[model samples]
Target: MVAFPDPNHAVRIAANELRIAWRTLRGKSTAQLASVGIVVVFGAAFTAAAAYGAYLGGRGLAENPGELSQLVSLVPAGLATITLFMAAYLTVVQLGDIDVRDGYLTTVPARDVVGGLLLSGYVRAAGLFTAPLLVASAAFAVGAGSPLAFPLAALAVLALTATAFLVGFPIGVGIAYLASRSAIVARFKTLIGAAAFLAYFGLIVSGTFDEAIDPILGVAQASPVSWYADLAVLAVVPSASAAKAGVVLAGSVVLGAGGVLASVRLSERRWYTESVEASERETDSVSSGRLDRLVGRRPAWVARKSWLRARRAPIKLVFVAYPAFLLVTPVQASVEAGHVTSSLPPSIALYGAWMTGAAFTLNPLGDEGAVLPVTAISGISGRDFVGGLVVASAVFGVPLTVAVAGGLAVLSPLPPVALACTVVAAAVLPVLAAALAAGVGTTYPKYDATSISRSREVVVPSMWAFGVYTLAFLLTAGIATAVQVPAAAGALANLLGVADAAVHVGALAVGVLLAGILATVSVRIAVRAFDDYTA
Candidate 1:
């Protein structure tokens, strides 16, 4: 009988594997190196800026010793919040990408496998924040004007940053593991990611409304950054700054210890076979084919396929949500700010057009993936395939445009001319979007599964498509504006009213005709590219 490996032996084996994994990651391609280098440069720049700021802060605090107490009181709270946000975002991205491709560490010992994953999480989180923190400490030291204080300040900042990472790591790993294994959790990931985005967006938006929320903000006066700022202030004042720094250092040690313990416990719990089984079961249920019916017969085939693809592919679903959210929120915000006419309430229709266009242009040929060879072999003309896709886009795209425009008209202060222009512009968007997709799809069809996320493979068409779509939207918007200006300026003037009506009608006709021409061109280009490649 074969004896099972001891837990100690398993851990040793895992550690070895982790060392190898680290080395393997170090041996990346030139492209990967460039990408990492860019990140590091950005990181270093941010750190240098923070360091300068800390120096300035320290100087100001030295001058006004009383401000030291206030700054000291705020740093912990601020640090805690920032740590949470960073950890959550990092966790989501790491977890989302982990199992995207097949053949991930199936042969490794279970203990080592888990250990490697946890270590990777740590590395990712640490890498993201390390530079900024080092810079901040360097800044604090320079500002303090004491070479002796520089090393001490650096040590203090490192301790705090490490503690934050420790706290965030296990939580992130546990959440990511849970999300990857369970379907319910996976669906919720999108919601979680969306919430995170909204929170970030809200932070920026809130600043715009800060005057109204001064009282609430006052309650948060003891934020963590403030405490750190105060610590710097105190360092130059009386010996009281030294005492306060001592307290902060001690707290950092305690927090760091607690975080490590928490992470270990979570990792152990996650490693259990029962937990993995339960997660797998949940995921299986989540990946069910409930929406397959939507992809019905000929005309409906493209729409159905697009819908199904969006549903089954989590990344696609997540991408689609961006346009959806933008249309509903920021677009609405723009309208409210008078950047957009109220007659174009950022609606589902607008999102559909935008998403459909993007999906087509970027992923058109790439989405076909391995099936492209089979498609070519089967003798299906590229023109026919392109036609089907265009048809599919229109099925979903047109109605969404109308609905958004109509909704905007009802809710906001839109003139009839403005409403007409909005509708005309909406109608033009998807066709341009589709045309762009076709052009890109024909030129840079990505075959590799790994190429999905980078999306740089479809660069040429993607750029051209974007330019075309931008121009088309601007032209449509201009036409609409011209029509609206006259109508708005002279609501009772018969000549202006007639001209506005004529322009609106003319714009719509022009848009549709242009769409037809572009669609034909896109189909022709796709067909020719398909033939050349296929032959």
Candidate 2:
């Protein structure tokens, strides 16, 4: 017998969910909250300063009303751009909050769950966003010397911000839905999300978004969006037309408010009716023969399976996050200045090595999943399993590091000897990273497949393992950096009272020797751990 779902209780459920999300936010670590608060405060201050500047510029151009039209457009352009970014960020955050923690959602009607979650997320986001917008607008008005313009301008800003955010909500929800259900998208969604986020920051930092407003101003001149700006400007300059404000307010309420409500309603239905899990549509077609011929069958099978799992669900590549961090400088520089510095090569090479360590070696036991007991019983020796992982990491990490380092070396302004050292570090460092990954990760294997975005059953390395690996990687990277960069090498040689050539040689030798020794020791640890595990 099917029980019909009741949605009369949606608001009640949504209220409860909101309370829970509030508590979750409240329960966050002090450092985490402090960091977030600092970012918000900084952003608010910047916005306020910019708003004050715009007001000053507008006031300066008041004598030429025709010229002031471009200034009028800046008001909406600034607010709308910020609002869009905030909306996307909030949407991504909200999408991540979805849970399959329980099947109660199955019985309670999907609409109620979606409605409750959406409403809760929306309210929380609105509360967090509204304060900053209001604060910046109020600061602008005070600086404009028009305290009376505060109420009307603040009201219009709030309305437009809300409308823009609400409109963005559906777009985010749609992307999240596709990610959850489509295997192909689910595989690359993390990369896509990262790209989109970085691109936005890139455009903003480069002042490209500001330049984009010139063409857009033409379209917005007589639009309601422009009137929204007019209403904001009127708050500063009382001489500006108030009739534009009235029409905008009325139109915003009628159209924007209606759209916001309808979007939520439709999103609820769409999310509920269409929700599905992402699952593989095709299985791996890898043959074990080639690997079996190269290594033993057992080790080859394990390696093959590991590669397949990663290929099928690439979100499991959490270790890549370390390498990605190293890219921030180069990416930001390229976006801002249209080029990367010569110094980026060593950093990039070191990061490649770090990725190798952080990759496949972690969570060997946990990664076995339901097959752990069977695989253990089959008695695949610890050395072979660990050895297989090292081989797996080397296959990709080694070439990746060497190729990238060599390529970047061509672009570097380093002395020839330094370039040679860079190439050496790139070659040997990844192998060392792979070796350490096996031992440390085996010692602190993570089995509980925690949620990363929407991908399920994705096992990652334990925090302990990651910390130790990162510490070693950083030390090694520092050494590599010192040896591979001409300035750093010369300084180190002077400080250590050694020839520059000798210092470079010694550093490279030490890095390779250190990595090899650790990898050897780490692989042994992995073997011991693997042998000791009983099903």
Candidate 3:
């Protein structure tokens, strides 16, 4: 029997695998490139802010050793809790699918294969590690008053992050193994996702209303993450806490190693699954035909077919629901919080309306996937096809926009005139969304298996739609502010209430007209692109 490669060889193999993955991603289309640029820009901005905050935090810790000591004590427990949650989520997502995709691992030497995979997982999680390490380094520099402290702090942070991933990965793989064999586990995945969302929402709400919950602070302090958070603070504090930090860090390493061993054992099982297959079957049986009836027997039917496609795709449904949820829940929460005053601005409500509209527009074309060719071959004019999509956008977009605007009016300080203007803007947003989606689809319509797998089709539409809505909100907010500021200063002396209302109404009308024109032009452009490609 031949001896397997050494540890160093395994690491080399894993590094090469990661390089391949990176190269594959780099070869994506122009749309994908733009999407990546947006993500990078956004991430860089957020990371810079976090690094600055960490520096300040470090300074504060140095000044207040006692507080830092308490915080640092909680780091280990916090790291463990985070690891547990992420591991559980990722494992569930992988269940039923990994065996088929990763079965090649069975043919490789067990230790080498396992080592490579574990290393790959860590590399994939580099983003998670980088942000915290930067913060820890900054914090240590400020707290310790020594440059050396920064590197030490970063090392401590990285170790803690790695420990969490180590613990999480094995548990996740085991769970995936068990989940692959059981229908109950599949249902549980959905439940877990929902629970996670609720838990996050609860945390945000509780933090915001911490003053009201002060009586239960003691009970809340009993949580494991709270303990870990304390450890994190202590890591930055000078003196005795450093020993405690070292102990916690050591514990993390042990736990991580154990988890990796367990995951290796579990990886021996063979399991294969694909969410797309199940999703497609379910969609075809229930939703595909439902829209055919609504749109009639005509092969040229665009609006009905597009709506059906959106409804059938589970991912698309979730994407649409996300914006709608954002629009509705916040307004309801603000009302409950008693934040609404009689003089509330329409800009706030209009912002929500525009967002809801844009969500509908962007996903339609990308969702078409392999069907794009059929539309071309079937003699369906791109103009008429896009017109139908506009109609469907109105169908879905107008109602949601109205509901959001009306909810905001009921909850906030907006007057009837302002509320009406908001509703008008909301109605116009769908048209804007359609125009943006059509433009993007025309420019970059080709998609492959990966696009379907990652749901990248939604990215361009979502991003561009968001950009349009944001610009609209800013413009409207500026106008509203300019008008309201002077009115308030004059104590309603030059309010000219009717004239202000008239101006808003006119603005909304103009926006809608412009959006409609844009939609028409976008469709024309997309049609030309489609023709060029097909020709």
Candidate 4:
């Protein structure tokens, strides 16, 4: 029953796939097209700048073959690591173009499908960088005063890219094969992916990524991967050996061919195998619990629904994690020194409160999706619906903010009195922030769904809502922070021509009172808007 792969058919399939991608690009929205244009322009500009820089460096180093040789050797190692890692990463994430998976797999041989998909991916990647890379190679060749260097360097880079992608793609496919068959991987794939990403992110933020890079580079340089350098600079660099160039060129072809064969086999296995199914299931219906009785059943149910959805599709709330990057510099500084700084506490409080509102409270109307009409006319008051969102955000945000901010404040040089105030503000600000966001979200809602994944789509909150809510949070949180920092408070006092004590006590009291007033007004507005919603 096994069918032989037709290379001609695979070529046609890849061409068709590329045509479809081009059509899709042409049909994108104006904003999407503009973003793509911006990226291409930036890429082209960066490429030109890099090529010019390389030309200058190459010309200078032409008289210093020893230095140039060492630099050239190191470049290929780093480049190999990057190319291999990126190719594997792209393959792992995409799992092949999903649109081609169905009809193509059923109609064509698995080998042909895999071949076409790989070709398509290669073409797409090459389309972006091939011209720029060739330009850079030519510049380097001219600067080095070797006419033969241009073709050699281009060959090395192109061969290296092709070989690395071929090798990496199979590794990714192998990983996919394991994931499809493994029950444990199926159950906790998301958590595993998140942990890997977080670990990688932590390394970069801590400026310790070199700890990871050093070993990879050392191993790569010691291996045949370093042979590419010989091919690249064979004519210009005295250290470049003809024998090594021959070995690398020959090895790359063998490896690339073997990788293609392995990929076809692996893809066939993976495509034919039934994927492991997750057994965990949620309850069929939402019911109000004892806590729900105290908080009103309708709002409680709504809150419960929101929590379930968040758990099921955590990507929808990925925006909440964006603020974590803001803490990197301050946290890194604190790590270098001994203790947290005064700045860290306020940053935590402000950004933490911002994260709270952004998590679940924003986009009240849009988040409801197809159920908007049903939910709007379900006889539940706007008070219940809006209250549910506020509760959902505050319950999680308040405790977390208090724990993080209070913990950091305890480690800082802040006085006991100020620490207490900080903790109190941390706990209270998130609640007010949630209410503020709910109000702004309802006033300026967005209902258009944006795709987050192949199968999942979500309606993100409007930029107007984000802008207005950020401004409101900054005002409220800024005043609270200023009151706590003596220098800031003194500045505020001098600006307003008030005494230090009045600035510390009176201003904070007034800020809290104003924040409370605003939160109340915003909540009422949100409730009214939700109640009157026709869509």
Candidate 5:
């Protein structure tokens, strides 16, 4: 009979994996490292403050055990639900993206690789809480006058977190399993995934997540997971059920072992399964046909190529969603109020133009990927190349922006003059935005692909490019919008301590002057950069 893979071997592999991850973080850019450091520092500080608050609260509630018990009992189920959701989401996004997976599985056991990945995910997710949780546990022991409570509570927390990962990882694997076998899923997965994210984001932004989560919490409380609360409070509370605590301990061990086996089995099935490939051929006829006659050959070819790539893999343009998040509050407020706000039209116009440029022209060189060498050598002039990107973005973005802005303006309370101004701004801003983005993109080109999912990588604009483009676009868009919209012009006048009429006239002149200079300089720079770009 074959012996099962050695548990110690799995433990060793997990330790090494964690070690490598830690080391790899050191190679990140200074800005990236600084950002990570800031996040970690804030997270640790927040948790420490929360632990102190919990200690103080525990001391007060110690005198009245019934009220404290009722509140504390709900903690287990809430925490478990949150942990399970987070772990499962991370696993789903990162399951099969393991580096050199085939080599690892061939050298070691498949179960061991699964074990290592599970441990890695758990540490990445829950490691920050270990110290703070221990401190809180000790504080509870002191408040309740039971020294044994600290160890028991800590142990309970550890077991619950472990079991949550054990169960959650398999659930993620099960999702990957279904996604792998279903062609329909393979075809529309991005749209479905985007819808789910937007729906969840809407709930949060609308402050209705609590309403949605209460039912889930109710189910968790009625399930066996509620045993964790009994185990946690067994030593601290005089009325805590010892029998339930015993059951939780035994159940945790069983679940943990079973979860490992399930993860191994599910991972094997998921990793080995031949994923369903969409058999549909891309129809290039539409993109190539009319566009060629409308524009000359070189520009048309470039525009068609850019449009085709975007249609095939829209995930690369996902960075454009960042602007949408900023607009959600205004849009949500308008939805609730049953009418468009004065602010919504301008906001939509500005961000719509921003999204238009970012969707395509934001990474001219790097976006070409393997074809960069061929594209660089192809007899395409810089003017034709940059003009093509401008044309592609403008073709789609301009009409959409004008339609959205004009449609909203009709529904809004803006004066006819302001409505006309808004439409003009919508039409003009996108073309300039695209030019600015192309220049910024070439200056800070990033060639590496960022992982969007387990099986897909997208070459989005670099952070430096994104930051620079945002600054330029906002400056340009703000000036242009202020000159066009009377309300905005009035606001600028107030901020600058100037007359409204003077601000409006000055803004118009400055806006036009800046737009002309920016458009001219950016287009020239982009053309030069594209012409000089070498693979």
Candidate 6:
């Protein structure tokens, strides 16, 4: 007879979990981590600046001796909120231990298996965020001017990190399971995700960062994150009690351990319970609805069809929203500086338009999923099929592009005529982007399973499609911006014996002309690709 060890053997279970987590992380890390490098690099730079500022902050403390101490006290609260939210949100999006649950339940007790998952979450959470945190803290310490700041900063970070993982792991794990087990949650999750994303975007748009106070004494001086600040003070200033730091450190560990056990128990109870099987069901169809009623202001039918298709899936909209994030920093800067700048308006408009087209128009036929072959064999002409896709994008893309760019331009300090020129460029350029994206995307179509979330698969646009569209849009936006700029177009206007206004208008005319040509050619290419495909 084979002997089996007690399932609740914490050490063994934790070790197994850690090993599996490491293997999982390593296996697909190349592609995922490759994309994460941009964020990592940006974080490193941000941390370096913070560290330099910390040195200055330390100096300020000599003048106001109590300031740093007061500031350190509130760090824990801020950390608490951040850890709670990120851990929970990420948990909902990424975590799903159902498969592991199925595998482990045959031998180990369910509680023990959950214990392992809890351990994995703890390890993964720390590993995921620690590098950036440590980098920033280390930099801050270097600038802090005392030899002791380095060690103190490390302690502070460790304490905060421990607290976060302890709290976040349980919440995240529980939420992940809830999302999996509950049909209502799974159904509404997309909208909730979009809302959460918009909230973050709202924060960036609000420009609340500009009204910053001194870091050592941030606005929240009485929060749990401040406990970490105390640890730092004890590290840098010998007069501070080691006993206090020891107490905080000990509390963090105890809390974490307790959280781990509670989380495992909670997960076992919920995950092992009877659950309903969830899946998608067909909804009422509206494809036959008239275009004018379905999509007002559009006398055309193609865009309306595209909208219906996108609304049904809506997964692609997430990718479409990528360009909007690019606006956050520039918009913040502009708000803080108290005026719209010429560059941001035109650029925002161009990205808006390009993304709109790419979102809907790029994968026209491929996005048809399994039904694509059927569409090809039908009586639909290439002009109607491809034209509808591009027009679908143009319908929303043109107005949105014009609104954002035109609004910004009007708000800018530029003369009225320049603003008018920008508005025109915004209207024309996206059509060009739509055309180019249509052609390029058709040329290099991607129709394969890609992970939208850890547990779900959907077909999104290819990397090549994104790259081609981005490069082309940048070049065209540059032309649009160049004409809008008073300086760049002044010499051209002089050379042609025309006013700057005429030159600007003429530049816009050129963009519109190019758009018309690109659209014609792109539609032709898409038509050819469709005609070549047989049912």
TM-score for each model:
0.72, 0.77, 0.67, 0.90, 0.89, 0.75
Write the residue-wise lDDT of candidate 6 on 355-393 in tens digits: 866877677666777888877776677766776676677
Model 1, position 243: C-alpha lDDT score: 57
lDDT of 6 at 422: 83
| Residues 1-535 of candidate 2: C-alpha lDDT, one tens digit per residue | 2222245555766687667656655775454478669977887776677567645554543434342366566666555655655565666645324555256456676545555554555566655556655665665566566676567668877777766666666566655555666767665666776687666555655558567655655554546677776677675554567897888788767765554454455455455565554564454435557777888887776777778777666767854764465566664565565554556677778888888767788677887888888877787788788878877887788899899877877776667777888888888888788888888888887787654433244677767787788887676555765566667778988999988888777888887777677778888888988888875
Error of 4 at 501 (Å): 7.3
TM-score of model 3 vs. true structure: 0.67
Clash counts for the predictions, in order:
20, 0, 23, 0, 0, 15
**Residue-by-residue lDDT tens digits, candidate 3, 1-535:** 3233357846965686577658867987665688789978877777766667767766776676654344454444454455555654554453212222244455655555656666765665544545755665675576557576676666666666677676777677767666565656554555665576666555554344354344344343454324334344544554445655566666767776676666666665523333222222333435545655655434225766665565444344444434434333443455566785433334334444444444444444455666766766776665656556656666666676567555656666555655666655555665565554565555544344334332133333544444554464445333333233224424333455446556555555665565556556666776666555452
The better-scoring model by lDDT among 2 and 4 is 4
Which regions of candidate 3 deviate over 4 angstroms?
Answer: 1-13, 24-68, 74-103, 109-112, 126-159, 174-250, 265-296, 299-301, 311-337, 340-371, 424-432, 435-500, 523-533
Q: Which stretches in model 1 have alpha-carbon errors above 4 Å? A: 1-45, 69-76, 95-123, 177-183, 186-234, 239-244, 274-303, 317-352, 450-498, 531-535
How much is 185 displaced in model 4, in angstroms?
3.0
> TM-score of the candidate numbered 5?
0.89
lDDT of 1 by residue, 1-535 (tens): 2122345544554465446546645875455567678987988787777777778876665566553454455554455456655765565455222331123335544333444444454555554665576567667667766555556655655565676666676677677567657766655655766686776555554344455444433554543333443344344656445655767777777876676556545554554434322232233323323322343233244445555565555464344444443444545465457655442342333445566666545556667666667766765566656665765666567677767666665555556655655665567656566665676556555444433321112121233444455455434333333334333434524545555466555654664565556556666787677666652
Candidate 5 lDDT tens digits, 1-535: 2223467776777788778667757765666688889988988887778677667656665666552354576777887887788777778877423677888888887887887787777887666665567677777777767777778888888888888878888888888788889999888887887899789778866668899999999888778777776776776566677788898889889988888788888888877878888666676667577877877789988887887788679778777886687877877777678788666777777887888888778888888888888887899999989889988898999999999987997898766666666777788888888888888888888888865654577788888989998898888676766554566777887999987667655664465567657767878888898888765
Instruction: Give the best candidate by TM-score.
Output: 4
Instruction: Score each candidate by Cα lDDT.
Output: 0.54, 0.68, 0.54, 0.78, 0.77, 0.67
What stretches of model 2 exceed 4 Å from their correct place?
A: 1-10, 23-75, 85-118, 136-150, 174-223, 233-236, 261-286, 330-341, 365-375, 444-451, 454-459, 494-499
Off by over 4 Å in 6: 1-33, 36-82, 96-110, 129-159, 173-191, 210-225, 229-236, 261-288, 292-309, 337-344, 369-371, 407-416, 485-497
**All-Cα superposition RMSD per candidate:** 6.9, 5.5, 6.7, 3.0, 3.1, 6.0
Q: Which scores greater on lDDT, model 4 or model 5?
A: 4
Candidate 3 or 2, higher TM-score: 2
